[model samples]
Target: MVSYQNNISSIDNNADADIPVAQYVRMSTEHQRYSTENQQLAIAEYAKRHGMRIVRTYADAGKSGLRIDGRQELQQLLEDVQKSDIEYRAILVYDVSRWGRFPDPDEAAMYEQTCKRNGIQVIYCAEQFSNDGSLQSTIIKNIKRSMAAEYSRELSVKVFAGQTTLIKKGYRQGGSPGYGLRRQLIDENHNIKGMLKRGEHKSIQTDRILLVPGPPEEIETVNFIYRLFLNDGMPERDIANLLNNQKIISETGRPWTRAVVHQILTNEKYIGNNVFNRVSFKLKMRLEKNDPSKWVRKDGAFEAIVPIETFRQVQAVIEKRSKHLDDSHMLEILKAILARHGALSAIIIDEEDDAPSSMTYRNRFGTLLRAYSLIGFHPRRDYAYLEINRTLRKRYPDLISEITSNIEKRGGWVTSNPDNGLFTVNGELTISLVIARCKLGQNGRNRWIIRLDSSLKPDMTIVVRMAICNSTIFDYYILPLTDFSPETLPFKEFNTFTLDVYRVDTLELFYQLTSREALQEVA
Candidate 1:
């Protein structure tokens, strides 16, 4: 357990020692006037009045009380209380809401029980109830928890309603203006203010955001995409490829993907329509795509990038390709394409105008393989390769988050690139992780392929070789980018000294090797 002893302080005026307690302060939003500092002041006044000395402080600034995920200080406070040699007898919170507005009241109770189990009482300074364990206090605390949760529910509803109103009035609710469009800031009086750059928002409360056409090149590119799809009859994937070949990046500053291209082709915003609430993630639950009927839309909300007729033509084409075919017809088309090409793949299916895109097949059937099986077409070799690749793709984000958390726990800062998952530690050493799948070579020897992203040019490359089953990692290879030049590295075993030098059984050594202190000393 990690204790926050560094934040501990004492009041020097009192001669006699007072009961030691820890003040826990949290501010969920900048709009809230009861900031962490204000909470601390209130807690200190309460402690002083009650003849209690605040020995430690744990504060989470600008952290939501909806869940414990981002509240690291609160998590540490619980951990410290659970320790056998805890120094504080009680914890002072501003109110029950400061503890949490967890959707489930039981969750709040459980955390408080944990602290109580460790003999550390949780006292709400602003609440009227005493800290004593009585029936009345328990009832009041439970009611307060429910009220906190209710407050969040009410606030979310109000915020959603406000956003819907804004959308109806032709204001961009949130999120980036898509490719070929820029966010324009305007005041409540509808006076054109100025263009808002990426990651920049209007500082005024009454300012509204609208979408306007971006640079001439980006506008031309958007028009070209529409013309390519509607007039030239190029598929979304081909258009993406063409843009990527031309080195044109998407609005996110990343290489274009078929999905990104398709989104441009389908979204109504490109045709000067304001659409809102197409998806709902209320109470931080899993996101669910709302039905078309549930979507709130306002037409002619902005200047159209593509002509309405051209946009409608593209949508008609997409809908004709998507909704015209039934499951059996789609499968039959896939079978015919497989027979014609002597193999089946996403790219192959996408390239064939006669067949729907691979995404359609995967969504219609559970997966492409399942559709292939239905068509009685199986590959010659084991098709677990695709499954293994899918697992690795899903594991990458989680692994990056875990690695980042580990680095932070060791007193290092991490800056991760969402585009490629490349990250830098302490703004000095960049690191990239690649997962290698174990395979059997022609000689019947276990082998692995480690592909490095040379474009990222990370200082160190951490390669995780998965087991044969692809369920868990076999071992790790922490190699410096300078030591390895090949984009694609083949490994048979770790018998050679050169290979063994980079081999590690765990990632602990990797963190130790890349510590800021260690890197600074080496520098």
Candidate 2:
């Protein structure tokens, strides 16, 4: 005989005895009838009739079942069952649709099989089958999974059609109002209402939304950007710099970027036009940008912030400058700039009024360096090194603070030298932090160059190799003084055995290396 403890009843071998089980529930926005509470109540009744006691519950509320990516509760339940010592003998779910509406029925079957392989049965309480591994039950489950996936497909098509109808009627479908526009709330009869603030939505179901001109400063800024591009002939980057230098913030309360400036210059909404379906992400698949021909447009949908003629002129100027420049012409301009400045870079190219923007050059030729090669100009120094150094200078203080905090948390002491910024850990070992910029070689492989600080030779050097974007660290290398030689180390892409022994993904290894240990002396 087996004794049970902690309110957990052991699984009875007798078919008549009660078995311990867990309940899983999920509810998406599509249906309130299959809500989490309703699913749980149905599962409770099913468990009582089947002589099974509910021991645990997992639920995901207001989550889509199209993909398992966002279902945290279901993920946790799977992880719990994967453990070797899980107590439950069975898992009860509301139905097949509540499990998932995965486009592939095999994906839903795989999840159910995983629970069965762990010596636990998965019972679809709301389904007609007994889930007893019979041919009839298997066929019904497969059919139900396919039906659930089809339901999502049909629903998506209907929702898109409804949004298109709204767009045709000059009602805003969704998304925040752009920089120089505010969303105006109105009743069904098209009566004047109040303006909606950021993140505020219409309270009544019958209300509609429309775009209206925003504040005077925002409207003036929009006009100024158009004039800067059209009349002054300033590029997007220059206009962004002008706005940022004046401490003017964008509608999103962030510093103006070149992309934001360009969007304002090109967007049709500024001229009282509504456009929809510029992109599509159907059935939770990859998002694809659609061609302009596929876009649905409604003219004079909102109040105009910029005149139509000025907007068209600006568009023509932008198109002539960007699209009309062939590769050879762009290269000739680059050569002229290189001849005058003795070097070429994105910033230098952007500063030139006669030349197209650096982004244009990049789009024409794969990269700036590639364009330089076409023009027969090889830079004497790697211009990227300067940018990488500047980024490192901005990041070093935060990295040092994090390291110091982690060391102190582990009961260890850290002191930094004011002269060279070398850290002495536990008053025993000195460490220097260095950043290595990642570069692509001619063979299309990743490489990192580590330039050691010989003048401030410490006990250990911590090297952070940046990723291709030069924004985040790819990997870390901790090298002791004795293991490193020479002033430079060039690393290739694949060096897992030798160089990878020193590579780590996080600072946790450093914490382990400097952890405090108690010592005892024996007589």
Candidate 3:
């Protein structure tokens, strides 16, 4: 009964029947530039191949993938779909995850089902859907999407781990390696930079390879900024704009954000401790703000770029500055900052890769070398040489247990690299590491041990060098009695537990032993 034109018009109303197509593209962080651009290009190419007219293209820039509501373009597209104005033959994208991650998959699947009921189809360019294929295809597609989410999570973990390691190494991890810092590479043997070459943490590790502590000059600059904001009453935004006006880009080549300026003024690394595992989460795929209780902070890992006194002063200033702000809102922002940066304002490390260096070893152990140097232990080598020294496990099987017990008993670090002899819990708060030199002459075989009786847990000392002296003298000190301070300090009961006949020193006995403090500080 109906006319031909009316019949054709009825068929044209179908949303899937429309030839014109629209494209949607998105990226989570500022880092995913290429992947997003590639997706957009792929969508464009698909349009050309299908002979479909190019229509509106929606894009969400700098949007996160954890939640869908935050994406502006996505919401717009959804609203347009609800209005049913234009027929969308297909909503094209590289993959379903390009929609969003986390709660996004469930939300997207629901939205897709609704669209299907409305006579629309989503054409994922990269994912070729097949109904007749193996059941594993569906599982694989789901896994692929899940992996995209996992990829973000894994990347966060790797970045955090890498950065933590680099920060510990003192090679400069980010932002022009804080004042007075110079990057150096550890040779294969883990010696204090076999050559004073570039630090590997900066060049090959993460996006933050040049994360180093402040050098003296830069330390001054850091101090200046902190003082300006707190003592001089300067504002964060004003400081950022001021730095930008001076054409001073941050070490990463980006204009200073107000947040970045604030962080510089508040960071503790500038004082010289390399804290690690401070703000970590199991689900890095959705790294939310971390709880302070969950943070693992190790003090004194590397040589401090800034003075401990200055670092304390800066924290005091920040506390005074932040106290008056709205706690609820500021806490939220702070939480976000913690999630993104783990309380790091700026790191001074090297950004160039050194030969025969793995980014991992440099970051984890290198920080401890710097820390030991700061407290005055004189770390002998760089990350390249840590394995040479870190063999404490092989040398002293009870090393970790001893340290852990000391920490539990005394409850604080005494001193690192104590007397190089028989280490014992002397007083309630004392730990002794014996340092002995074998006499070189006929007397070299007979040695006198210099015992530095210091605090134990309350004053934990990391003994870096067990005995680095004339080789022959090593045998005499190797079996000296001064190794046990508590036994000599009126602890007759402890004497029974101390070693009676000490082992003779050989080339293998001449390695460094980390105090509990040094071990906690590095990783």
- Scored by TM-score, the top model is 1
Which digits, one per residue and each the tens of the lDDT, describe model 3 over residues 114-217? 55556555566666553112376457656766776677677667877766566655434333343334444444344443223333342322222223444455
Model 2 Cα lDDT, one tens digit per residue, 1-113: 11122112224545446787899999888667798889898888877766778999998898889887557677778778888989788888888899999888999998888
What local lDDT score does residue 105 receive in model 3, on the 0 to 100 scale? 52
Query: Against the unseen true structure, what C-alpha lDDT does each candidate score?
Result: 0.80, 0.81, 0.48
Backbone clash total for model 3 is 90
Per residue, candidate 1 scores C-alpha lDDT tens digits across 1-523 of 1112211122223434477899998887645557988889888887776667888999898888887755667777877887898888879898899999888989999999988888887888888776566687789889999999999899899989998888998999888898999999999899999999987988899999999999999989999999999889998889999999999978876567777888898988989999998999887745678889989889999999888999988888888777778888888898899889888876567667556877678778867778889989887665556766886888887788888888887888899888877898888888888999887666645788677667888898888988754657888878887777664353764333344556766899878765655355564
- Please say which candidate is ahead in lDDT: 1 or 3: 1
- Residue 224, model 3: lDDT of 66
lDDT comparing candidate 2 with the true structure: 0.81
Candidate 1: 10-residue stretch with minimal lDDT: 1-10
Provide the RMSD of all predictions against the true structure, rounded to 1 decimal.
11.2, 10.8, 28.3
Question: Where does model 3 exceed 4 Å of error?
Answer: 1-18, 27-37, 48-51, 61-64, 117-119, 131-144, 171-267, 280-523
What TM-score fits each model?
Answer: 0.70, 0.67, 0.37
Worst 10 residues of 3 by lDDT: 346-355
